[model samples]
Target: MAIAELGPVVLDCPDPRALAGFYAEVLGATAEGDDEWTDLKVPGGRDLAFQAAPGFVPPKWPSAEHSQQFHLDLLVKDLDAAEEAVLALGAKVLDADDRSRSFRVYADPAGHPFCLCAC
Candidate 1:
């Protein structure tokens, strides 16, 4: 038997509900769960879960001051459009410099750094 199988990647945030909702919108997934725990379910992709972490400290991007154990890389057809949409969904730009790059970094509402890749 296989020793382990991949499961939903869970993120620790101050508010599970809020974080789950943000990602759900970003990934076009559905958010479901209680306050302490939330899951973002996509139609044909791995699911994402969020859990409430008391006194949670948002990760510092491009800095080792606090650990960012995990991050998601979302593929987009148009970086400009995706950037606008994500910003509207409460995501903040962390690194806008894309000069001849395929990906750009951003921070979600809770400050988790993620990237939008064109490749």
Candidate 2:
């Protein structure tokens, strides 16, 4: 038998519903779950889930004090457009270099780092 195949990824945050909503908007998915847990499913396949973590400590990007542990790499059609859209949806640029680069780092509303990649 083969090893376990990957399923959905779950992120821990202070508010599952709100965090789920943010990912839902980003992936054009829908949030489904109660106050304790929420799930967001992308149209094609990738799935994301969120759970409420009381006293959740957000990771400080570019700092080893609190590691990010994990982050999502999102493919976008246009970097500038994606930047604008994500900014409107509560994503803050953690570190943005020259536009000529293919990827940029950002922090979600919950402070988890994710990358917007033009690939």
Candidate 3:
């Protein structure tokens, strides 16, 4: 018999609700579960879980040491609009590499860095 698979990604955050809310706003997903740990279900059955870690320390991206372990790259239809929307939702723009490349770096409310690339 074959074993069934589970959720693809499990993300740790200092505040599960905040993380879940951010993801839900970004991906149009719904946050599920209680206060401790929450699951954000994306399209096509892909799931991203946010577990609460009271002492979570967010990673610093593009650094020599203690860099971000993983970053979500989103292909945006309009980079400007996307950046504005995310920023309005509490994401902080880390760098605007418009002179170098097409993608711009941003950090979530919890300080997890991500990228928004023009599609």
TM-scores for all candidates: the values are: 0.94, 0.95, 0.87
Provide the RMSD of all predictions against the true structure, rounded to 1 decimal.
1.1, 1.0, 2.3
Name the candidate, 2 or 3, with the larger TM-score value: 2
The global C-alpha lDDT for each of the candidates, from Candidate 1 onward, is 0.90, 0.91, 0.85
lDDT of 2 by residue, 37-92 (tens): 99898888689999888899999888888999989999999988989998999999
By TM-score, how accurate is candidate 2?
Answer: 0.95
lDDT of 1 by residue, 4-117 (tens): 999999998888999998888888999999989998998788999999999989998877778777889998899989999999999999998855788989999999999999
What lDDT is reached at residue 25 by model 2? 87
| Per-candidate clash tally | 0, 0, 0
Candidate 1 overall lDDT versus native: 0.90
Ranking by lDDT: 2, 1, 3
* TM-score, ranked from best to worst: 2, 1, 3
What's the C-alpha lDDT at position 35 in model 2?
Answer: 84
Flag regions of model 1 displaced more than 4 Å: none
The ten-residue window of minimal lDDT in model 2 covers 92-101
